[model samples]
Target: MRAAAAEHGLTLDDERDLTPYLDLRRPRDRFIAALVGAGRPLPLRGEYWRMLRGGDALQWCLLNGLLNYRVLYFRPAAG
Candidate 1:
């Protein structure tokens, strides 16, 4: 990707760098609500986060340990 961008004489910055500006209004409000209501991370998915914030936002929250995610493992048993 860097090579491709360089070929076109374009300089690129990582999208992650821009994540800090993501609409944290919801996240902040929710975080406070969670503290007051449950005292835990509001359990949600990246999709919902995106819908609430916007594309490419909230990544910093996740990366910076301000948020977290879950991994679901499944198996098709005895195929």
Candidate 2:
């Protein structure tokens, strides 16, 4: 996996930092993947951002969590 990432110019200095994200890529998260594959929005957990955005899954997930929550429950996803 490290070699694959390195080929793409992605550095994996901390294993823990990316392991969880990789888990999200597996069959266990198949439902979410299927939803996105079908062009449907997820239920505001922001796990999808990790796939869409490159930097720090932790950070994107944090901000997107709240944003998705607000978008789903209170308003549209974007203005």
Candidate 3:
């Protein structure tokens, strides 16, 4: 895995950084992945950013957690 990432100019300096990749093998991640796949009904990427921009106070904590998780773990594909 590290070799593949390095080939793509990505560095895995910490094992914890692989949590998202590992989590992505689970059912929930599969569902999310499929939902965000090309031509899927959900525009998950846009929705996430939009929600972060104007989400209500009721969802503040959840949104904040999502933001933190995304920042700390999510790694978009390279090229």
Candidate 4:
């Protein structure tokens, strides 16, 4: 992930530089803080966290479905 970000000229110095501005006590809090610091509007209450979690779940399901389909339909035949 870090390599990919770096490839796009993006830096991930959260551990040292942005840690002071972030609340590292909780994952959700840190994520929200980073978004706000980057000038992004935050969602009300826990909505941001919920939405992120839901998106992750959906992505996982899609990737799993694709992998299963590939295995079933595109596998190489054994001699």
**Which candidate, 3 or 4, would have the higher TM-score against the true structure?**
4
State how far residue 25 of model 4 sits from its true place (Å): 27
The candidate with the higher lDDT, 3 or 4, is 4
Indicate the residue-level lDDT of 71 in model 4. 15
lDDT of 3 by residue, 19-60 (tens): 244222356544444444433454545777444334332234
What's each prediction's clash count? 0, 0, 0, 0
* TM agreement with the true structure for every prediction: 0.24, 0.21, 0.25, 0.27
lDDT of 1 at 20: 47
Model 3's TM-score against the true structure: 0.25
Candidate maximizing TM-score: 4
- Candidate topping lDDT: 1
Give residue 6's lDDT in candidate 1 (0 to 100).
60
Residue 64 local lDDT, model 2: 52
Model 3 lowest lDDT segment of ten: 67-76
Off by over 4 Å in 1: 9-16, 25-79
* Candidate 4: worst-modelled 10 consecutive residues by lDDT: 67-76
lDDT of 1: 0.48
Off by over 4 Å in 4: 1-45, 66-79
Ranking by lDDT: 1, 4, 3, 2
C-alpha local distance difference test of each model:
0.48, 0.42, 0.44, 0.46
Q: On residues 4-56, what C-alpha lDDT tens digit does candidate 2 reach at each position?
A: 65565555444332233333344534555454555435444466555633333
